[model samples]
Target: MDLFTESGILLLPRDTFLTDTHVQLLQKQRIWEVEVQQVLSEGTTENITNQLMDLDADKETVAAYVKALDKTRSLFDGIGRDDKPGLEQFSDVFYEVAEQSMKQLGLFRSLYVLEGSDSYTYRHSLNVGILCSLIARLLKWGEERIAFMGLAGFLHDLGKMRISKEVLLKPGRLTEEEFDQMKQHTVYGYEMIKQMEGGSELLALCALHHHERLDGSGYPHQLKGDEVPVECQVLAIADMFDAICSDRVYKDRTSPFEAAQLLWKEACNGKLNIEFVSHFVRYIALLYVGARAVLNSGEEVEVILIHQDEPMRPLVRRSGEFVDLRHERTLNIEKMIG
Candidate 1:
C-alpha cells in the first residue's frame, strides 16, 4: 500500500489513500468523505513506524523520511504569519521530525547525499543532524553528547525565523544594513533556544558559534578555533557543507565534490579543521557511489568507488572509458542527477 495519499497525507493500512479526485472534491468543500483532520491525523503504517524506530536504511523507508520532510516543510512555512502560529511551536515540530530522520540516516554511510537545494532551511537542519550524529558515532561519543549535538543541529538556524522574509529570500547581495541585521540572527537564535524548555547551553552555543571561523573572522563573535567548543566545530563544518551544496535564492549551488575540495583547501589554509574535513569527506564519498551524476562535459555517468585516498574523485563509467575523475584533467562532477 502507498504510504502517502494524493493529498500528500500519511495513510496507514487501516486508512484508505485519497486520490487526486478526492483532494479536488475536498477543495470544492464537498466535505463528505475524509475531512482534513482525519486525513492528517492518519498515523504512519505500523510497519513503517517500526522501520523508522529501528533506524532502517532501506531505500523505500528512506524515501518515506524524505516525503515526511517535505510535508513538515509545508507545515513550517505556514508558521508566524497574521495567523501567528507560534514560532517556538513550529521549531518543536522540526526538532522532533529531525530527531527521527537522523536516527534512520545514521544507519547508513553518510547523510550528505540526501542533502539537496529544493528546501534549504528545513532540509539543511535535518542534514546537519544526520552528519553530526554520524560524526558522533565515528568518534564514539557518549549517548548523551550525541543526542545533545543532534538537538544542536536542529536549533542551529532558529535565528533565521526572526529575520524578515524580504531579506531571507533576497536573490542578490545584501545592503550593509541588511547584512548587519542578518548577522544578528545567530544571537537571536541562541537566545530563543535558551528560553525554551529543555534547552541546553551547549545547544545554544551551537547556534551561536556555527558561523564562527577558525581564524576568528566570523560574525557575532570572532571566536578563534581553539576557543570554540568542539561540538560547535562539528556543527560548523556540517553547516558549511549543507550551505555550499544548497541553492540559495542569493547563491548558486555547488557539487558535493567541489564543496569537499573547497573545504579541504580551507583546512589547508587553517580556516577549518583538516582532520575533521578528512573524516567528513571519507563518509560523504561513500554516499556518492553508484549515484548518477553529470560530468563537466554534461554527460551522464555512474560513479564507481575506488582509491580511498581520493574518494571525491571516483572512477566513473560514462560511455566506455572508465574515467578516473581524479586523473582526468578536464572531467569533474558538475552536478548530481537522478
Candidate 2:
C-alpha cells in the first residue's frame, strides 16, 4: 500500500507490498496514517493533524523556508542559462535570508527538519547556506564574514548544472568513471562562480574546496591540515551533515541526533575539523533535550540529559527508567519524533 503525510505529500507511493524497511522509514519520519482512493485527489484534507512538532519550525519559519527554496530553485535554473540571472539577485535574497534568520531562536532547528525530501538539490543548497550562517554566528564571526559564508553555501553546487540530468539523478550507484566525472562539479562550480559578476575569490574557493577533507582524504585536492581554509572546512562539515541527515534517492533521512553521531565519528577519524564537529555535536544534543525519539529497537524515549564527553549518546527516559545511551552503545536515537 502507498502512504502519504497528512499534508498530502507523497511518502511511499503505491507499493504492492510495504517491506520492513518501508514501514521503518515511515515510522522514523514519525508519519502515522495515509489516505487511499481509486483516484487520488489533488484536493485537501479536513482537520489534518500534523505529526511533526513545534521544535521543527513555527509556521512563519516554515513559510520562509518554502519561499527560500522556491527562490533558490528559480535562481539555480536561471543562472548561466542565457545570463538572465544576475549574481547579486541571488545574493540579495540569500544574504537577507541568512541574516534575517539570525534573530530567531533555535536557528538550527528548521535546518534539521525540512520537508519535501526529494527536492534535495534545491533544499540542500539553501540548508547548507543557512547552516553556514548559523555556524558563523555560533563562532562569533563578524557580520561580513557570516554573510560571505552564507553566500558561499548558497551557490556551492551551481556547477552541478553542467552535469547530465541522467547521471546526476540516477537512483543507483554510479560506476567509477561516472563518479570521477561527478567530482568535477567542484571545479565546475569554482570556475562558474569566478566568472560571475558579483562573486569574489573567497566565494569561488568555497565552491571549489568545500569537498576537501582535513586529513587529506577529500577530492579535487589532497590539501591536508592547515592547508585547507577554515571557510572550506566549515562548509565541508555543513555540506556533509545535510547530505547525511536529509533524505536522498538511495536512502531514508536519518534523524538530526543520529546525524550528529556520524559527524562526531568523522571528526574522531580526522576526516573533519574536531573543533567544529565537537561544538556542533554538543549543541545538537543540548537542543534536543526533552525531544521525543524512537530507539532502533522500536521503543520510544525522551532525551533527558546530554553527556558532555559523549554528546552523541544522550541519556533518555523510557518506561519510567532512565537509560544512559553512552553505556548502551548499541542503542541509538534513531529518529526524533519532533
Candidate 3:
C-alpha cells in the first residue's frame, strides 16, 4: 500500500513494506494512523484497512505547498498566454504557503524533499518565494518587509514565461545564441512587472537585478556591489540556492550541504552577499543536523553537529563512528539520502 501525508506528500510508495525506522520517523512526526491495502487470494480481493504509522506532523504545511505549486503553474501558464496576472493573484497564491512557513519550521525546511511532477519553473518559483521569506525573517526584518520579500521572490523569474519552449526546455547544453536569449528573462520579467497594477519600482528592479552579482559577473546590466539593491541581494541568494539544490531539466539536484558549500565559496570570492550567505548557509547546515547523507567515499553518515566556524563541514556519525568533516577535508557529502 502507498502512504502519504494529508497534504499529499508521498511517504511510502505502493507495495513498499514498512520498516522499524520508517515507523519511528512517522511516530516522530505524529502520524499515528494510515490506510493500507491488503491483498488476498492472488487477485480475488483487495482489502483496505487502517494501519499504525507515524511521521512528521506538518500536514497543513505540506498541503499548503502542494496548493501553492498548483496555483503557480496556472499563473505561469496565464503569463505564457500573454495574460497579465495581477499582484493580488500572485499574493493569493503565496500567502498560505508563507503562513505555513512561519509555523512548521521542521517540515517547511525539508519541503524540497517532497518534489513532485510539477514543472521546474513553477516549483522553483514557489520554493524561492518560501526561501526568500525565511531569509528575511532570519535577518530580523519586520512582517511587512518579510511579506513583500516573499512576493518579490515569487515573481523573480516571471520573464521565463516569455521564452520559447525549445529554449526553455532543452534537455542538453544550450548554444551561445540560445543562452543569450535565455539571459533576457531578467529584462522581460522587469518589463512585465512594471506593467502590472500595484507593482512598485523595487519589485520591478528585483525582477531585473536578482541575477546581478556583487562581482559584476551577472547579466542584464552587470550592476555590482551597492549598485544592486539590498532586496535584490536577498533575492539573488534564494534564487541561486533553489536553482542549485533543486533538480532542473539539464542537471540533477545537489544536496543542500554541498549547495551551501558552493554558496559559501561564491561569497568568499565576492560573487554573492557574504553576510547573507553566511547566515543562510549556516541555517541550512543546521536544518539537517539529524539527516542522513552519502559521502563521496560511498559511506552513509548521519549529521551530528554543525561547526560554528565552518557550517558546511560538520561532525557526522558513520557506522556508529564519528567522523569530523572539518578534519577530513577530502571527504564531502555527495548527496542527501533521507
Can you tell me which runs of candidate 3 are displaced by over 4 Å?
Answer: 1-57, 114-118
Candidate 2, backbone clash total? 0
lDDT of each: 0.67, 0.75, 0.81
Off by over 4 Å in 2: 1-56, 105-107, 110-116
State which candidate has the highest lDDT.
Answer: 3
What tens digits encode model 3's per-residue C-alpha lDDT throughout 158-205? 999888878887779999999999999999999999999888889999
RMSD of each: 9.2, 11.3, 12.5
Error of 2 at 171 (Å): 1.1
Q: After best superposition, candidate 1 residue 88: deviation in angstroms? A: 11
Name the lDDT of candidate 3: 0.81
Give the distance in Å from residue 107's predicted Cα in candidate 2 to where it truly belongs.
6.2
Q: What shift in Å separates residue 123 of candidate 3 from its native position after superposition?
A: 1.0
lDDT ranking from best candidate downward: 3, 2, 1
Model 1's alpha-carbon lDDT is 0.67
Better of 1 and 3 by TM-score: 3
Ranking by TM-score: 3, 2, 1
* Better candidate number, 1 or 3, judged by lDDT: 3
lDDT of 2 at 176: 92
TM-score of each: 0.74, 0.80, 0.81
